[model samples]
Target: MRRSGPVRALLAASAAAAVSAGLVVAGGGAAQAAPAFRAPMPAHVVAPYYETYAGGSPAALAAQSHNTYLTLAFLQTPAAGSCTATWNGDATTPVSKSVYGKDIAALQARGGNAIPSFGGYAADTTGTDIADSCTDVSSIASVYEGLVTTYGVTRIDLDVEADSLSNTAGIDRRNKAVAQVESWAHRTHRNVQFSYTLPSTTTGLGATGVALLQNAVANHARVDVVNIMTFDYYDGASHEMATDTETAAAGLINQLAALYPSEKPSHLWSRVGVTDMPGIDDFGPAETFTTADAATVEHWAAAKGINTLSFWALQRDNGSCVGTAGAGACSGVAQSDWYFSHTFEAFTHSKWTWGKGRSPWSEPKPAPRQAERGSRM
Candidate 1:
C-alpha cells in the first residue's frame, strides 16, 4: 500500500547474534540457516503491516497493542541489479539475526510471529522488487527460503502494486520462484504460506490482479491467500468505505469461484483476505475509513471466515493527525491509541454467527444505505 509521505530515514541496524551462527550461505546463496522455532499462522488472523523503516521494536509494539502477528513491510534489494534482499533496501540490514531477529524471537516467545513482506509502493515504482531486480529465478527463491529459516515465519506477504503490477515478466518470475520455494519447503518439511496483496476496485480485483492469480495457477504455485487492499479506489466518487469493502470483497469471492471451481464457497472464503487503510487514505476525505467501519468489517469478516484482517500500518492506528489525509504516522481520525489493533485482534479467535438457515459464505447483504455523507472528517 502507498503511504503518502516522504520516505523515512532508515534506522541503524541492531547488533545481536554473530552472523556465523545466525546465517551461513552456500550453493550460491541457496542455503538455509538452522531452523528456529516458529508458530503456525492462526486459521484466522489480524496482522497489520508494521513499517520497519519507521524505527520501533515490533515485539514491544505487538505486546503493547495486544497484536500477536504483524506483517513486516518490507524486504527488497538495496539497489537495482542486485539479488540480495534487505530490510528497507538497506545493506546494513541483511536477512540475519543482526536485524529484527531478537524482536521476532521475543514475539514468538509470546506465541506470536512475524510475516516478512516484499515490494511496497516504493520498491514497486523503482526497479528494486526482488523478482524485478534479480534475473536469476533460483536466487529469488533462495531469498524466500532464507526468510523462513532465519526468521521462522509461517507466512510471507508479497505487496504487488504500482508499476510492479503491470510488469508481466516480473509477475511470472515471482510465481515461478514461489513454486520453487514451496517445493523446497516440502522437501525440508518446513511450514510456510504465501499471500499476494493486490489493489482492488469496488467490484473486485482489476484484470491485472486476476491475471496474476491465473499465472500462479498455471505455474502450479499454491497461494494460500489473495489479500485485497480495500481502500484507495481513487475513482473520484464519495465513498462509504465500509460498504465499499463489502462489495469489493463479494466481487472478489465471485471471481475466486470462477478460478477455483472445485472449492466450496465456504472453503474459498478461507482464502480471501482484506486490508483497510485506517482513517483517511491517500485520496483524502472522500475515502475515510472510520471507527464504525472497523467494527462492521470485523464482524463481517468473522462471520465470513476470511483468512486475514489488516490495515496499512500499525503506527497509524491512532488519532495523532485528525483531518490530515495519508499521514504515515497517524490515522487522521479521532480514535484512541491502538484502537484499530485492539478491535482487529479479536478476529484471531472470532466466532460470529449468521441468522438461522443462512450460510455465512452465501451472497452478501446489500450495503447499508450510503452512510450520511455530511462534513468530510
Candidate 2:
C-alpha cells in the first residue's frame, strides 16, 4: 500500500498485550468477540486491498462492490521498539474485532473473508514493521498467531518493501517467525498461509526481493504467494499497462522457478500473484491502468491460473480524481464506480485451473533474464 505525508512519531509504551481466550481488550471496556472462522481462500481469488487507514467500512465496501475477499492493509507497530502490531500503527487498534472484527465477521457471514497484510511503505521505512521493531523471534510469531486466532483469517500478506527489504536482521527474524507460526498452525490444525508482496521491475524482483525469499527458503518458511506490484515502474518510460503486467508476472514465474527448482511450471504459476494499481499509480499517466487493462489482465490471469488477481485498493475504484497521482479516494481515470472490482470479481470463481495454459494476452515463459536485475519496480 502507498503511504503519503510525514511519518508520525506515535508511541506504544509497552509490548502487545497477550491474547486471552481469543479475545483482546479494546478501549471503552468493550470485549470484542473473536471473528468467526471462515474457510480458506479459494485457490484463485480476486482480493483487492482495502486501505484500513482510509476510514472505509470494509464489509460495506465489499458488499457494495460485490467482492468476496479483500486484503486489509496494513498492520504495524506503534513505536520503533514496540513488539506489538496494530492496524495503521495505532496502538488502540490491536488484533481485535473492535478494530475490524465485525467487518470481517460480516464479510465471512456473506461467504467472504479478509486477509490481514503487514508492512506497507510507511511501516517498512519507519522501523515499525513488527519484525524490525521486535528482535525476539518468539514475540513476532506470537503477534502473527494472534492475528490468525483473532480474525480467523487463512492468509497473511507481508507487504515487505522499501527499507524493510534491506534490513537483513529484520528479514531473517520475520522468516524465522513465519516458520514458527507455520509450525504452530500445523499443530493447531489452522489453515495459515503467508505471502511476500514485493516491488518489482518491469521484468521481475531485484536482488533484495530475491534475497528476502531466499532467506524464507533458508528458514523453511512456506511462501504461498509472490504477489508483485505491477504498476509504478517510475522508470521514465511510457507503459502498455496490461502488457507490462503480463510480462512482469511471467518474469516472476521465471524467478520462482529458479527459487523453487523442484516445483513444476504450473505449480510456480499457482504461487504467482500480480497486484495492479487501478488507474493512475504514483508514477502519473505514464502508467495508467485503464478499465480495458483490467479486463485484459483478468482474462490473462484466469488463463494462466495465477493464484491471486488484486489491485492496490478498492477505495480507488472510481474516477473521482482524474489525472491525479496516487489519489487515495479515487482512481485517476473516468470510469463507473467499482468498475475494477466488478471486472475482477469474475476471478473469484473456482473454475480456473492451474495447469499449463495459454491466453491471447499471455507472455511466453521467459528464462531468468540476467539483464533484468534492478531494485525499483
Candidate 3:
C-alpha cells in the first residue's frame, strides 16, 4: 500500500514526535522499566491455518508455551437449513462431524483456546448479509455456543474484514454483521475477541479503510482486540527499511489508544501488530542475526505501552539461523533451524520490567555498536 495522503500526515506527526525526543538506537535485551502508562497483560502470537497444521504439532506446542493465547479456527459458513449451523469446506460434514469435533477437542486439550472466525480479507458481501440477518445471528450463535459447550472454549476470535468500505450499503452491512456477532458474543457469555489483518502502514488500507475501523471502534464498545497485520510492509523490494514503517505502525496504535483509552480493558490489550516470517523469498537475501532485532521491536512496543505481538504463520518463522555469517547453503530455504534456534531467545528477551518509578514506555537505549537491519515483516 502506498504511504501518502492522510496516512502521510499521520506518519509526519509521529516522526516529528520521535525526532523531538532524539531517536536513539538501543542494543541488548535487558529488561527496562515501564513508563507511566503501562500496557495491559501481554497477548500471545497467533498462527493462521485452513484445516491442516502448517507448523505441525511441535510448532503448536512451542507457540502455546511461548505465549498465553492460541487461535485454532478458521472462517466458514453456517450449514444450510440449520439455525446456528456452521461448517468448513476443508472438514467433511458440519462442525459435529467426527473430524471437525476432534480438531476442536485437540486444541482445547492442549490448553489452547479455539474459535471459529467468520470473515477474512476477501470480499464476502453475501456472507456478510447472511451474518447480518437476525435468523443467521441465532444460527451462528447456536453453532458457536455448541462449539464452546462441546470443546470447553472460553473465548471467540471474530476475524471480520471486508473490501468495500466506501459504499453506504456495504458499510451498513458490515456494521450490522459486527453488531450481530457482538450481540451473540454477549449472549454466550464468552470473551469475544475481535481481530483483523490490516495493512502494516497507515496508508496501507487507504482512507476509507482507516475510517471504517475508526468508526467501528468508536461505536462498538464490545469489540475487544484489533490485531493489525504489521508485516509485509516492504515486500522484499526495498533494501533500506523506511523509518516510516516503524513510525507509522506505532503512530496508528497510539492514535487508537488515545481514541479508546477508556473503552479498552487495559494497556496491554492495546496492540501495534506485526507479522514474522522465518524467511521470505521476496525480502532479498536473508540476513541472520541474534534474537536481538526481534527483541528490540518488542521492547519498543512495550515501552510505548503496546503489548500484543502477532506472527503471520507458525510454519514460516520455523527456520535455521545463518547468524551474521550471511546466507549459507540454506540461505533462502525455509528450514526449522531459525525458529528452533531463536524461539527461546526471542521469548526470553521479550520480558518487560515495569515498576513504580519508570515511565510506561521507557527502554534502555541501544548500545552504540548495535546496527539496525532490514526488519522481517
Candidate 4:
C-alpha cells in the first residue's frame, strides 16, 4: 500500500540476518477444524491508510464486518527531537484538533475502534521518522501512549517500511520505545496489543524486517502480530497473486517456527497477518491483485488460521472508473461498491476458538446501489 522504492532488490541485496527465514503466527491442534481467526471482535477486515479523503464510512464499515480503521499517521516533529502527532498529513492540524472525533465516536457506537498507525512510507521526509528522529525513546513512547490512551485503543500498528525500516539505529529506538509503551499499558491494565507492518517477498522479510522481528523476540517485546504487506513485488510479481501470497506467508511461517521453537505451527499462524493490494497496485497495470484473488487468498488464510486480513485502503473498493492505470481511491476493477470489503468480510466472521465453534456475522447487508463516488490507486 506504500511506496516500496525497489523493494525486491533491497530484500535481495540486504544480507538476510542469520535469524529465522519466514513466518506468521498460527494456533490450535489438528483435531480442531480449520476455523477463521476472527481478529478481536469489531476488528476483522482491518483497513489502514485512512486519510481525510475517506471522509465518511464508519457506519457502513461497521455494519459490513469492518473494524478498526487505522488512522493514517501519528507524525513526529523533527527539529525538537521531541514529538507531536497529527491525524492527517497536515503538520498544522494536530490530532487534538478533534478532526476525527465524530468518525471515531461513530465507529465506537458500533462497537468498533480506531487504531493509530505510525511511521509509514513517508517517514523519511515527513519528519515523522520516529525510529530515526525520536532518539529519546521515552519521549516517543509518550507520544504513542498519548494517542493510544486518547483513542482508547487496545491495539497499535507500526507500518515500518522504506526508509523507516532501513535505519538500524532507528529500529533499535523503535523497538525499545514500543516495549516501553507496552510496559506502561500493562501497568495501567489497558491490555494494549502491539503489531508491526513490514515489507515482504514470497521468500521472507527483508534484512531490516528480519532484524526487527528478531529484536522483538529476543527482547521479549510482547508483539501480538507480524503483518506483512504482500504486494508490490515488482520484479518478483507473479501471475497468481493469491498463490504468491501463500508462498510468501509459508516462508514467513517457517521463519517464525525457528524464532519460537516452543510454539506450535497453529500458534505461529495465528500471530501472522497478510495485507494485500486487492487490485491494480501503485506500480502500474502489470501488477493487479484481483477480487477472485482476494477470495482464494481469504480461503487459504482462513484455512491456515491466519490472524488478520486487510488491503491498502477502503476508498478504492468500488466500481468506479480507474482507466488503465492504478488509482489510490478506487480499486481498478468493474465491481459493486464495497465489493472488496464484502469479499474480505469472509475473514471477519467465525471465531477460531481452538477446536470450538465458528460463527458468521448476521448483520444487515449493503443497500441498493446508488450513484457511488470514487477516485483511483
How would you encode candidate 2's per-residue C-alpha lDDT over 1-377 as one tens digit per residue? Answer: 57643211111210121121122222323343544333456678788998888664676667667887899999999999999899999987778767787767656666667899999989999999999999999999989988877777888999998899999999999999999888876655456778889999889898999999999999999898899999888899999999999998888988888899988887788888899998989989999999999999988988888888999888788777788878877888999988999998887664675333222112223333223221111
Q: Per-residue lDDT for 120-204 in model 4, tens only? A: 6666545466667667777777777765545455567787877777677777777887778777654443445667888888787
**What are the candidates' C-alpha RMSDs?**
11.7, 10.6, 16.3, 14.4
The clash numbers for all candidates, in the given order, read 0, 2, 25, 25
Worst 10 residues of 4 by lDDT: 17-26
lDDT of 1 at 343: 86
What is the C-alpha lDDT profile of model 3 across 266-348, one tens digit per residue? Answer: 34334444433233322344322223444555555554444344443332343343331212112234445334224423432
**Model 1, which residues run further than 4 Å from truth?**
4-39, 352-377
User: What is the Cα-based lDDT of residue 118 in candidate 3?
Assistant: 48
Give candidate 2 regions above 4 Å deviation. Answer: 4-37, 354-377
- Tell me the TM-score of each prediction against the true structure: 0.85, 0.86, 0.57, 0.77
Residue range with the least summed lDDT across 10 consecutive positions in model 1: 9-18
Looking at model 2, residue 187 earns an lDDT score of 53
Question: lDDT, candidate 3, residue 28?
Answer: 15
Stretches of candidate 4 exceeding 4 Å from the true structure: 3-45, 53-82, 125-127, 236-238, 354-377
